[model samples]
Target: MSEIQNKSVALVTQIEGALADVSPSDRAQSFLERSLDLYFALGGPPEAAAKLVTQARSRAQLRVESAVANVVIELAAASHLSDIDMIQAAYNRLDVELKAERSKK
Candidate 1:
């Protein structure tokens, strides 16, 4: 694969691993944000944008069956309580962004 493709794949892997010890919802939201950023960063054909969002949502739903329950548990286990709020805020921001991006479709 090309370097950019490699980078994207690596980022996906890293996101997954980072959130593996986390809760399902958090993992989904985090991965989606990370993927969306990479998708935007590597802008190209419209096809890429379409595929990127689809893949991101796919990753999110895949976490529904996961062991971790919600974003809080994941955040608390992964970081300090102070940072937990930040993580939720971040996830909310990403959720808004993703919704906007999807609305354009």
Candidate 2:
């Protein structure tokens, strides 16, 4: 089993075989980045967010790559997952966000 699969099955079995691709934060951040990119592709917050996405992408990839170098890199394989992972991450993020919002309420 791949690292992502293992993580999903072990941690959130419900999302197993579902979250094939996507880091919750990365997906959320990417969504923000894309929206910003559309709003101000040339410059402004969108451009800034785009840069952040790039850097974060590199950082995320590097972290996984580096860790894999140190140990085993079965999970995620340092590759960007798929839309399902993104959707799963989004749903998970939404859940967390809702919980936080509810707690505040």
Cα RMSD, each candidate: 16.8, 13.0
* Candidate 2 global CA lDDT score: 0.48
**What C-alpha lDDT values do all the predictions have?**
0.53, 0.48
For model 2, how does the per-residue alpha-carbon lDDT over 1-105 read when each residue is reduced to its tens digit?
764445434444243335558466645564455556434633446346567767866753556447545433322232133223543564575567556655754
The candidate 2 region of ten consecutive residues with least summed lDDT is 74-83
Going through the candidates in the order shown, the clash numbers are 0, 5
- Return the lDDT, model 1, position 50: 77
The TM-score obtained by model 1 is: 0.25
Stretches > 4 Å off in candidate 2: 1-34, 37-84
